[model samples]
Target: MFKSLWLQTAYSRDPYPALDQDVTCDICIIGGGLAGIANAYYLAKEGKDVILVEKDTILAGATGNSTGKLTAQHDFVYAKLLKQFGLDQAKLYYGVNEQAIEFARSFAKEGEIKAADSILYSQTKHGTELLRHEMRAYETLGIPGELGKNSELPIHIDATLTMPNESQIHPVRFGQHLAQLAVEAGARIYEHSDVVLMDLKKRLLAMKSGHEIQFTELILCTHYPIEALRGLQVMKLAVDRSYIVAAEGNMPLQGQYISVDSPKRSIRTAQFDDKTFFLLSGESHTAGAESNTEVHYKRLNTDVQELYHLDTLTNRWSAQDPQTPDLIPYAGIISSSMPYVYLSTGNRKWGLSNSLANARIISDLIVGRDNNASQLYAPDRTGFGSFLLQALKISGLVVTEFTGGHLTRTNAPICTHMGCRTRWNEGDETWDCPCHGSRFRKDGSVLEGPATKPLNLK
Candidate 1:
């Protein structure tokens, strides 16, 4: 049930070797997810020598688990962005995402990424009002979209905002293709090369295999920045996990769609091994908030059975997303103090487009090109008034979780990131930290970070 559809049909290649010796490069990238590969692709295209290291194989993180929806219509976010970041920044957000989608179209093979319209619908009156506001924002921003009452979805929807020319792709295949293109452009990629130590000031990193890399520039594209540096990203960003279940059914939805209402439902279609399947996803909660995460899968399965009547469940999986207080990603420089270090994260759940956009932003900054979107996602940007309050609320929750975690009586180990007690997630069978969203394997190895070191079970 926990198998990811994309990973199941993943592009296969012989595993890249771990870093076997010390190396020096013009740029060194951490993490091998879509963001890392995309960064390598663009940076290498500029003829910059790059080395990318991943603890696991490429795309094994959020990219492999993603639904691969590449669209700028991110679940009625335009209205909120307009209200918060103002019109220009909001427009820039949509523009960059659109550019990222076009990049995907240009880069992907014929069938790897397919064109599809994207839709955001709502079932309740409040949701309808939200969509209306979003429609206004779209119009004001010169985004092409229209209001509708119906779609190819089986469930009833009160209103929908449709944006044409969006696309969806096989995340694993596209990432592998990017990796291949990057390698062709003279980029080096290594798998199972866990970065165990780093001296950012010296711009040197040591991997688990004892080999060290020296570079003039460092880019961290890990789902969560493994190194908090001085940015305090652990306090500014919150981690969310969403579940997806793929059912074997010939019936397909017309376009990629998501609901603006509570208990969000995202719908898309996929073809694997000549069999058509539909992906039903939603039920987002904080990473470690739910102990028995299996209930989420059960709820998703129930929704699929009732809505699509697909009983043959093929696969179920979940992806972790880092969310910022202002809802915009932190994609550029980590901090002013560390000028050569860059990190991209907090894409919410729309990493497919945001990752590519962030990679572009970072590559442009490294190559000394002018990118208007850089300030929009700068990690060091101060939060707005409301976002400051939201950030404080998140910090308060972290404090509560930290206090409550220590008071509880359990055999659970403490999280290495912030010492919060870890919770066992039944669905994924990982130890998850409620405080900062760190995850660990059953054998006490780090699965996700903010927590760079493994749990000490002893």
Candidate 2:
């Protein structure tokens, strides 16, 4: 069942090797997930020599564990974006995501990626209202969309929003395809090579294996930047954790969906060798905040069974995406403080769309071109109320971790990538888990699950 759901599933192939000895390139991207691979593809296509380094396999990070929903409807995000940043800013955000949908369709047609069925829905009254607001926002921006009242499923929903051309794909397969194409286009990809430090002054990347590569420019595409340079990405962004369950179904689910309420739930389906599999995801909380993720899994399993009459969970996984307080991604020059460095992050759960959009933005910035999307996604764009709220949330977590009983003394104190205190992960160890709920060892070996890899100490 695991093999059918994950092992033999569409996105499992590996990519070519990295340079065995020190090498140089026009740009060195630090992660091989969606953002890095996509960036490499575009940059290489532009005739720039690119090198991508992955600590593990391509898509092995959050991209591999994604639910694979490729839509711009990021759950009542437009309304918030419009309110927090002005309408002009919100429209820019919407336009970028819309381009992402088109990019996915084009990629699928080119056989770089395959399209899966997708359905949009408003699972709550609030969500239904948000749908109306979103439609008005889209109309004002001159975008096209259709309102869906009834879904193909037997279950009832408050309202549905269908983007007919939107799609889903095996992210791993898509990532690997891009990796190969990038290499064929003259970009190099390396795996199992972890970058430890960046010598900005020397314009070189130092690897944990004691190798250094010099580059004219650098892209910090790692899930989070490993080396703490000038930009405060840790303070500017927060990590959110979401779960997914892949289960065998007697029948196929009509399309992909997402819920608007807290602890959101999303639904979608894929067919493999004549058997239908449903992918259900949601229950987002700040990463390591939940005490028991298994409970969340059980609840999702129960919901699927109750709603779809399906039994037997096949595969389960979780992903962590960076959430910016402003509800937009960060893509462009890293900061005015650093000239040669660039970054792309704060994707929230919309990495499928934002990753590609970011590629275009990053490419523009690297080549000294003007890009409105790049300005919209700039890391320094600020002055939103959401920033204050995010600060409060992070502060609360810090206070709770220090004084709350959830934290148990352990041999190796756990450390969150965002610097929150980790509680004793009794069930797993590798430091107890909470915050985003990822468990790590005293030396950082992932024990429980969900986390695709151990903490990136280097």
Best by lDDT: 1
**What would the per-residue lDDT of candidate 2 be over residues 1-458, giving only the tens digit for each residue?**
32224434654455557556888889999888889998998899999999998876677666778877777767666667777767787888878887877866765534334454444577688878778877776666655567768476766688876655566776766667767778788888888786766788888988767788999999978656665457666556678777777878777655677765555778888765667788888777676665566776778888888988788788877667878777788887877878678888879888988898998899888888778877788876666554787756755665676555334543334454444456543222235344434457557765322233466445
Give the TM-scores of the predictions, in the order they appear. Answer: 0.98, 0.88
lDDT of each: 0.89, 0.70
Instruction: Give model 1's TM-score versus the native structure.
Output: 0.98
What is candidate 2's local distance difference test score?
Answer: 0.70
lDDT of 2 at 53: 89
| Residue ranges of candidate 1 with Cα displaced over 4 Å | none
